[model samples]
Target: MVGKCPSCGEWNTYVEEIVRKEPSNRRAMGGLETPKAKPLSLSEIEPGEEERIDMHDEELNRVLGGGLVPGSLVLIGGEPGIGKSTLVLQTVLRMPERKILYISGEESARQLKLRADRLGQISNDCLIVCETSLEQIYVHIKNTNPDLVIIDSIQTISTESLESSPGSVAQVRECSAAILRFAKETHTPVLLIGHINKEGSIAGPKVLEHIVDTVLQFEGDQHYMYRILRSIKNRFGSTAELGIYEMRQDGLRQVSNPSELLLNQDHEGMSGVAIASAIEGVRPFLIETQALVSSAVYGNPQRSATGFDIRRMNMLLAVLEKRVGFKLAQKDVFLNIAGG
Candidate 1:
């Protein structure tokens, strides 16, 4: 259970063995670097037009840059109970007969199946596993060789090489790095779900974001029923792509037009309410901006914002009254996004 470190070259730095996975009959195919390979043709190495999957949802397809790319690493992150797992589970289930391996460190197969059943009839090719160790998941992936792989939440998976806890900075970083290496070497597309901290950022190390090919953050206010999928980093597709969805009793329905979902038209022509178009990735959407100006009853004024950047709004208001020649410097201002 020992191997030399690739970086430090320290003998026995890696524990080659850990909580072992169940055996499988699948074997890795030799890569292009095989010794017996024939001379390559110009067209052999030339890539054809990218092919994509059609999951019957335009918003999801748009976020995935027309569709899921083969051998791509996609990281999905979100706040708790925000339907990160639900969206992916439903998508994989509804996919058109593609072999898929799903591993959940937090839930068992029976539990996932119960939810899948409630989601209606799913494809038979999707398989489920409840595992915590990265090595164990790798074995299942190698054996199944599924078209798609989904890790429910990467923060729960661990690698034995690091002695730290599973969700710690070091473990998250190392585990993600190992998974990335395996996916690239094997040319198997993998989807990793992640937990976000209270600060609205991914819980693990920042480097975890750098390791993955695509980073998708699922964002929505707990009080609101609309959700947004934003691609922060994407090597295979446009980084500016945005996906919109609405939470209904059945499941998440794609919102082709987000303007209706993000704006509240009940209060027409309300003061201090402005609609602005914000661009994420390569797509642009309309979001309502709400502001309230109240007299400073006491000597000290309070500046508060919900869902919007407080500091930036403060700076903007200051610029408005000072440089832009607006009045009322003594008023207190409150700002918030309609549905964040």
Candidate 2:
């Protein structure tokens, strides 16, 4: 006689199972929860001054919407070989008054000290630890009670409850969640260094970005000395703000006047060069626009542009021909935004 399984509703899916009871020993992976508070009306809530910690870097401070807010979780992501670690370390070294905990899951204390020495600034209050276990990290946090905490790279840290390996989706999600909970409970600001995937997005689930208070992206070509720190998401500030830096041997230097440095001072009388005024996050600056017009040597004219949108260039060229009455439609035109 055939018997159907009630759950699966299939005759062949039925099977005998053995159940065994095991003692549960897994401890909760979050900070101690406080007693729930009653909801307050909007009018009953009083706004207090937000204490911000200065990073001592003007560019960084501007990108962070004036300064770093306490109890905020900020994530900085970038491509490999970018100056993400250097930027964070330099900022931390400048803050001598604040007690900082530099947690490194990828590097050792000796290596960090060596880098700090090369940077030529050392803070006595700064502490370094080479650990990867999330639980143990929390223990150290409780013991040290630092004013600011920085995680070198979140992808390298993991928890014991997760069966997946480090850098996995499950591990990254759980570790970030734990950190967020701890930050909120302790009212301590946490800075997280994150890895970017091939597509340039943060290497984790989308929910990870949602949990953070601010998200900053460090972007630049390794071949170039210029780097841009941009805010992708900011709960307390504007997302349109950006910071510029020049990578040097000692450390990353803030570019106070990016417009002056970006413009070519000697190219005033040069042909095919134009200067245009632009605004980036309330700052007005001048930009150099260059155009190159040449005869088409091949049968098909090649059009190229850099640092500016290609379609916009095409539309401008069409306008020049139609409105300005610039003949020579067969000529090749190339445009570029200098020092982009």
Candidate 2 per-residue lDDT over residues 224-257, each given as its tens digit: 6899999999998889887999989998988878
Clashing pairs in 2: none
Which one is best on TM-score?
2
Give the runs in model 2 whose Cα sits over 4 Å from its true position. Answer: 1-38
Report the lDDT tens digits of candidate 1 across residue range 245-292: 899777888887777766887868578888889877665778998888
Q: When superposed on Cα atoms, how far off is each prediction in RMSD?
A: 8.6, 5.9
TM-score of each: 0.76, 0.88
Model 2 RMSD, rounded to 1 decimal: 5.9
lDDT for 133 (candidate 1): 84
Q: What lDDT would each prediction earn against the true structure?
A: 0.81, 0.87
Check candidate 1 and list the clashing pairs: 240-281, 240-282
